[model samples]
Target: MQDVRVIPPYPEANEDGIREGKSKSSKFSFNFNLKPKEVKAHLDKYVIKQDDAKKTLAIAICDHYNHVAECIKREREQGDSKSDSDEEYTKQNVLLIGPTGVGKTYLIKTLAKLIGVPFVKADATKFSETGYVGGNVEDIIRDLVTEAEGNVDVAKYGMVFIDEIDKIASAANLIGKDVSGRGVQTGLL
Candidate 1:
């Protein structure tokens, strides 16, 4: 598909705003005549390892496009009457739990990188129960918003990794909660 530039009129013209023949707004738009597989092939040249994670992200992007395509088809069939996202099939929200340093963090981050989505990694230990002294739980979201960048507005639509969840149960005990060995089962559950 080709895009034609219909530049809006600017009352004022400066060297920085309009140089040679093109306006500054054209810089924000991108034009590419390339296949996705070709782009992936090029990215692979620089990104080493994590090929599976990269491919999974590629599939996810493809699925998003598939969903959009399906939406377009539905609009075509129905003409003016169309259903919103609430009426359509939704994607599943996933929770990933595993041992430490098992690529849980890396997998999410790699997926974000491959697909250009925002991502946040938070430790459950940061949040305390009831009267525990530390930063607020909402701060996590706030931090994520401040940390987000690029074409990826991940803070609005992204993934989160909650680490060290087991510690939440372990820390709940004040003194005698762990002496009976019941804490282990209480935690692993």
Candidate 2:
């Protein structure tokens, strides 16, 4: 396994968590202590403008990782046999809407890098509901696995960012079936 440099939980810490010339390795361990403001500040260095989008994404990302950390701690304390019924955690999913060239991709990609998590980016136009000509929805999971170096555990906590999601909107004027648009959307759900 590649050694992942863990970042300190403070906003003023460096990328590699080096403080006073000390370094720590956090391999296969989730040490998420990032606040929403810290995340937004990190994005501000790379992505220009889009303050609202950055803030929204920062909150969602922090919520998701914080929940994951809590669940991991809980599982460690209790046995793994405790099923999902024991606790309920609503997934923090966000839908970002904006015009083209608004730094959407850069924002997400940068955030994923800062958190040391796998990220899979796919264009909606290349996918279809059926597994005939276009890519399947399951491809996203497969790509995540690849991004995590074939580690399923890491992929589970990964983020899948789909671009051009609006392209999948089903048009009422279309006859017969709308496999690419409506079908893809349904398959995602």
Candidate 3:
């Protein structure tokens, strides 16, 4: 007589249902090799008209990401050692201002998708100053961290879309001061 064991058909996974101990966020790899023209072409597939916005966003995004990649490469080449005096390039954050339904958000979302990075879209109106009921501006960074599965490195490069940014401005006709609005603006700065 012989004894035999049978294996389950389904793949084994961790308690969180992630197989192979890999974070789900790790699935998408950043495409640091993307060119500006290539990005615009990809955007064309999802976005309708708005050639000017697409072109501008594509160029700026590509330039920023390329700088990030270059920094990483330089650090690796230097054996992760800082030089006595090294000039570091600051990340240029782009602000998209336009009327509603103008695809300001859609543009960044499409770019994030094309770049294979995590994207977090939040509304500026939803945040308040610290010690308030609503969320704070830094909460956006925490959201990014969560979206990246607690990977700070990935979250650092993730795109955050803050909609309704103009709503943070203080109202002129208000009888009393606008605490939330004005406070949020200051916190963001």
Candidate 4:
């Protein structure tokens, strides 16, 4: 197993936006040292075919975790002071589209396990716009927290796989508003 360096809790800003002492809550961060090739190599062992998808996912995973490590490093160095450099950081979001039976879920699950992070999978069709009516998008985050054993900080780095996203697409020919489709999309955003 690869060694993972776990970051301990640091002083965080309070409700008044002031960092006075060590916060009770821990923000989970880690050292991501694996290269893209290393990740792809591991995937190749379990997943067959879909070289393009594997390569893309490997690169994306490496980039994302590296960026997270950098951010954690910056936070540690800066202490309580906020940095303007954060604004320059671009967020990376990946949307994987493929036919059924593809190893999309398996690939992601493997990567998450390899990196020792939380992973959650949800069906888009089950979620509705309103929380009272159906599954709320925020439930995904909550599920991540649960996977992290109630550690919100660790959950922050968790991966959520929302399957059947295409099912939520609004049909053009619909007479009225597609609550489950468009509403779910908006909620996800």
TM per prediction: 0.45, 0.78, 0.74, 0.79
Q: Global CA lDDT of candidate 4, please?
A: 0.74
Better of 3 and 4 by lDDT: 4
* lDDT of model 1, residue 50: 51
Q: Candidate 4: deviation at residue 56, Å?
A: 0.4
Worst 10 residues of 4 by lDDT: 11-20
lDDT of each: 0.45, 0.73, 0.69, 0.74
lDDT of 4 by residue, 141-168 (tens): 8898888777776667778999999889
Candidate 1 weakest ten by summed lDDT: 11-20
Regions more than 4 Å wrong, model 3: 1-31, 80-90, 171-177
lDDT of 3 by residue, 1-189 (tens): 121111111113322211112354443223266677877887887889989888889889878888766655667677653443336655567788778898988899877766555689999999987887888899988988887677765667778998888778787676765657988888877
Cα displacement (angstroms), candidate 3, residue 49, comes to: 0.9
Best by lDDT: 4
Q: Across residues 1-189, which tens digit of lDDT does each residue of candidate 2 receive?
A: 223343422223344432111122223455577788888888877888899999999998888787767676677888563456447767778888888887778788787787766788999999987756889999999999888767665667677899998889888688886778888988888
The candidate with the higher TM-score, 1 or 2, is 2
Error of 2 at 137 (Å): 1.0
Off by over 4 Å in 2: 1-27, 80-88, 171-175
